[model samples]
Target: MSAPFLRGVEALAQFTAREGAGAAPARGHIERLLVDGEEHEHRLGIWYANTKQRRDKLNPAQRTALADLGVTWA
Candidate 1:
């Protein structure tokens, strides 16, 4: 996977770990995660909303990955 997309997945994983599954983040939600020995911040909710909006555009692998993460709507 591309680095940025990987990071967003990491951010979502972290958010899920912290907030539990099925929690819909707010529009301004932010997730800070450690990835590749560095810290990165993801605009979690915005990314999520956008992902939902563009769900049909995601490739199978991307969709599968999100589904594996317990993202029901993915």
Candidate 2:
């Protein structure tokens, strides 16, 4: 992947880690990652399922954002 894409994935991983710790994730940053990291749906879904609370925090708009990026949940 390109460097920016890799960076986005890194940011997403950090966000997921923070969320797992019960911290409020940086929403804008994570959204940007989700938007830019379009090819990472599987990774994103795995991260989404990493924490129940964090997963629950994804609102309808966020789910729409993910869907726009072609991310889908099974």
Listed in order, each prediction's TM-score against the native is: 0.86, 0.31
Clashing pairs in 1: none
Per-residue alpha-carbon lDDT of model 2 for 1-74, expressed as tens digits?
44543453455455555565333333323333444556433343344444333546556655554344334441
Runs off by more than 4 Å, candidate 1? none
TM-score of 2: 0.31
lDDT (C-alpha) at residue 52 in model 2: 30
Q: What is the lDDT for 15 in model 1?
A: 84
The TM-score measured for candidate 1 stands at 0.86
On residues 1-74, what C-alpha lDDT tens digit does candidate 1 reach at each position? 66667777878888888888877778799998776798878898898888888889988888887887788977
Query: Residue 12 CA error for candidate 1 (Å)?
Result: 0.4
RMSD of 1: 1.4
